[model samples]
Target: MIARLVARTFGLSIAVTVAALVVAYLYGGPAALFVCAILAILEISLSFDNAVMNATVLQRMNAFWQKMFLTVGVLIAVFGMRVLFPLVIVWAVAGLAPAAALDLALNPPAVETADQPSYQTIMVQAHPQIAALGGMFLLLIFLNYAFDEDRRVWGRFVEHWLARLGRVRHAAIIVALAVLLICAQIVDPAHRSSVLTSGVIGILLYLSIQGLTAMFDDDELPDTLDPAVPDPSSTRPAERDRPAHLPVGGKAAFMLFLYLEMLDASFSFDGVIGAFAITSDPILIALGLGFIGAMFVRSITVFLVRAGTLTEYRYLENGAHWAIGALAAVLLVSLKVEVNEVISGLVGVVFIVAAMISSIRANRADARAATQTAAGVSGP
Candidate 1:
C-alpha cells in the first residue's frame, strides 16, 4: 500500500512539472526551454542536501500530513517563493518598477545579461560579500546542530538581553528583526538597506517562517507510528525477539515536510540570487528556472524513493548536512563580500563527495563484518 502511494504521488508530481514546462515552452521559445533546463539543474544541484534534510523529518510523518506536504508545500515553493518572491526582492533592492520587471520577464532581452555585465557584473562583483553571507549562515546552522553549548562573549551585555528575547519562540524572531532594524538605524542610518542588513533580515526571515509553520501546524509532530513498519535488524539473542520498528506518524511526517522546505529555502537562496544575477527578468527566472527546476527536484525526490537511495545512500545524508553548512557559509559571505558561485558550489560538492565516499566505506565495512560473522558460524 505504501509503495503504491509513493508511486502515485511521485507520478502526479512529475505530471504537474511536465505540464508546467510545456506551458512555458508554448509561451516562450527555445530560450525558455534552455533557461528552464539550466534552472532545473541549478535547483537540483542546490537542493540535493535539502531533500535529505526533509527526509529526516518526512520519514517520521503520517500519510495525511505527507500528502498535505507535497500539495501545499509545492504551491508555496513554486508560486510564493519561486515566482513572486524574487520580484518582490528586486523591487525592494533595485527599486525597479515591478511592472517593468514583469515586462522584461515576458519579453527577455535578445542577449543573455551575463554576456553584458553592467548590472549583472556589479552583482557578481559582490561575490565576496555574497559568499560571506552564505558562509556565515551555514556556519551558524552547523554550530547550532553540532554544538550544545551556547556561550556569551560579553559579561551580561544589553545585546545578550535582546538575544534572550530572540529565543522567545516565534515571536522572538520578530523581536530579533526589530532589534536588527534598530541597530541598523543607529549605526548606518544612511545605508540601512546595505547587504549586511539584508543578510540579517534574510536569516531572521528564514527562521521566523520555519518556526511559525511548525508552531501553527498541529500535525507538525505526529503522535503515533504507522502499523505497517518493517522489523528492525537486531543481532543480540534477546534483541532478535524485539517487536517491529514503528513508522512515522502523520504529524511527524508533516513536521518533516516543513523541515525539508525550510532547508530547501536555505539552500536555494544563493541559486535564486545568482540566477537573478544572470537575468533580471522575473518571468524568465520563474519559467526558466522555477518550473523546470521544480520538475527536476520532484524527479530526484521520486528517484530517491524508488531506488531506496535514502536508505542505501545513507552517507548522502551526511554529505547534504555538510553541504547545507557550506551553502550557509557562502550566503553569509555573499552579504559583506563577493564570491563566485563556482566556489560556493565547489565547497558544497566537496563535502557531499566526501560524505558519499564515507557512506560507501561504511557500507563496505558493514558487509565485511557480516560476512566474517557468517563464515565463523558456518565453520564452527
Candidate 2:
C-alpha cells in the first residue's frame, strides 16, 4: 500500500527531477547541478505548508479539477510565473522593451553598476511590490482562518479572543487594511504609493476569487458529519445522488483552479527572489525552482490528499494557516528589512511540527476517553 501510494504520488516528480538534473548539468556542469539540487530541497522545505494549504482546497475539488491542477496548473506555474512573469516585471519596472527584458534575464551582467544592474539586482529591486501583493493576500488567508468562528481553539490562549472577533462584521477586512496601511508607512516614501496599490490589488484579487467561488460553489454542507442520516433540506436532486466532493466542475472548478494558481504564485514570490541569492542566472533558477521544486510540491499535495492526512491529523490545516501568517509577516517585514530565507522557512516548520505533536496528544486523550466510556458501558 505504501509503495503504491509513493509510486502514484511521486512517480512523475521523480521522473521529471532526473531529466531536469541532466539538463542542469549540460547547462552549467556540476556546480550548477549542485545548486539545482539545493534549490529543489529548499523549495520543498519552504513549500510543505503550501502543499497542505493546497490540499485543503484541492480535496473539495473533483478528480478532474485535481488532475487539472497537477498538469495544467503546474505548467502555468513553471512557464507563466516562473519563466515569463519575472521578465514582464523587469520590463515594466525598468522601462525596458520586451526583447531587452528577455535579453537582460538570459544574459545578465556579471558585475553591477548604476547603469547596468543584473537580473538579480532588478528582481531584488522589485521585491517590495511582490511582497506587498503576495503578503497581503496570504495575510488575509491567515486572518480569515484565525477569526473563523467554527474553528476549534486547540493551539493558543489568544484563539479564544480571535474566535470572538469573528463575530464582528468584516473583522478580517478591517485588520487586513490596517496591516496594509502600516506596511505602507514603513516602506520608503517613493515606493509607498506603489506598495499601497499592490496591497489593495492583492485584497481585491482575493475578494474577486472568493466571490467567484461562492457564486458557482455548491452550497450544501458535506454529508460526512452523519452520512447515514441525510439532511432532507439538501438541495441536491433526489435522482442525482453524488459524492459531495465530486461534480465540482464548470465555473466553480475554474475559480478553484485560478485560486490554486494564485496561491502557488504568492508562495513562489519570495522563493523566487531568494533563489537569486543562490545564483543570479534566471534560467538556472527557473530550472531548479520551477521544474523540480514545483513538481514535488504538486506531488506532495496529491500525497496529502490521497493519504487523507489532513483529516487524520486534526491540526494540520490550522498549522499551515498559522505558518502562512508567519510567512505574511516575514514578507511584509522583508519589504523594508533583510529577512533570512532560512528563518522564514524555519518558522513554518516549527508551527507545523508543534501542531503535529499537539494533535498526537489530543488523539491519545480521545482514545483513552473512548476506551473508558466503552469499558463502563459494558460493565468491565
Candidate 3:
C-alpha cells in the first residue's frame, strides 16, 4: 500500500511538472523550450540531495502542507526566484523603477542586444552585497550540516532572554523589518517604504514558512549507524520502524517550506547571474530557466519517490548534506568575490557523486555478506 501510494505521488508530480513546461513552450518559442530543458537538467544535477533534504521533513507534513508545497512552492520557484528576483535586485541596486529595470532587461542597446542587461547584470551590480549576504547564508548552512554542535545564528543572549519572554519569533521578525527599513533609508529615504516593505516581507515570508516545516522533520543519522554496517538495507528498515521524533507538524511544515525556498534562493544567486552570461534576455532566461528548472525539481521529487531512492541510498543524504555545505561555502565566497555558477555547480556535483559511489559500494558489500551468511546457515 505504501509503495503504491509513493508511486502515485511521484507520477502525479512528474505529470504536473511536465504540463507546466508544455504551457511554457506554448507561450514561448522553441528556443525557450530548449533553454528550459537545459535549466531543468542543471537544477536536477545540482539538487539531487535537495529532495532527500525535503523528504526528511515533507513526509511529516499533513496532506494540505504537502499540496501547498507543490503548488505554492512552484509559483515561488518560477516567479519569485527565477523570473522576478533578478529584477528586484536590479531595481534595488540600480535605483531604477521596476518597469525601467524590466525595460533594461527586455531591450539592451542594439549593439548590446546580443548581450542585454539580464539577471547577470543585476547580480554584477549587486555582486558586492550579494557576495556578502550569500557568503554568510552559505556559511551558516555549512556549519549546521558539517559540525557536531547545534548551530544558531542568533546570539545566545537574544535567544535565551527574548525567547524566554515568549517573543523571540516576534522580536526576530521586528529586527528583520528594522534592518530592511534602515537599508531603504540609506539607499533612498523617500522611497524606502516601497522597496523596504517588499524586501522584508519577501524574506520573512519564506523564512517563516521553512521554520514551520523544520519543526516536524526528525530524520538524522543515529550515532551508531556506522559506515562499517555490512547491510545498508538493514539500516533503512530499522530507520523506518522507528517513529519520527522531530518537530514536524503543520506549522513546522510551513516553516520548512519557507526555509527550503530561502535555500533555493541562495542557490539561485549564481544561476541567476550565470543565465545572463549565456543571454541577456530576461524573458528568455525566465521562460527558459524558470519553467525548466521548476519542472526538473518536480520530476526529481517524483523520481525519488518512485525509486524510493531516499530510503535505498543512505549515502545520498550524506552527499546532499555535503553539497549543502559546499554551497554554503560558495555562498560565503560569493559575498566577497564573484563565483561562477559553473564552478558552484561542479562543486556540488562532485560531492554528491562521490557520496553516491560510496553508497553503492557499501550496498554491494552488504549484499555479499548476506549471501555468505545464507550459505553458512544452509551448510549447518
TM-score of each: 0.66, 0.91, 0.67
State each model's CA lDDT, in order. 0.56, 0.84, 0.59
Q: Write one digit per residue (lDDT tens) for candidate 2, span 6-62.
A: 998899999999998999999999998999988888888889889999999998787
Which parts of model 2 have CA positions greater than 4 angstroms off? 218-247
Worst 10 residues of 1 by lDDT: 147-156
User: Cα lDDT for residue 142, model 3?
Assistant: 44
Ranking by TM-score: 2, 3, 1
lDDT of 1 by residue, 18-124 (tens): 77668657767777756665666666676656666665445445566655666677667777667765555545545656675455455555675654323343334
**Candidate 3 segments exceeding 4 Å error:** 1-41, 110-120, 149-243, 335-338
Lowest summed lDDT window (length 10), candidate 3: 147-156
Q: Give the C-alpha lDDT of model 2.
A: 0.84
Model 1 TM: 0.66
Error of 2 at 239 (Å): 30
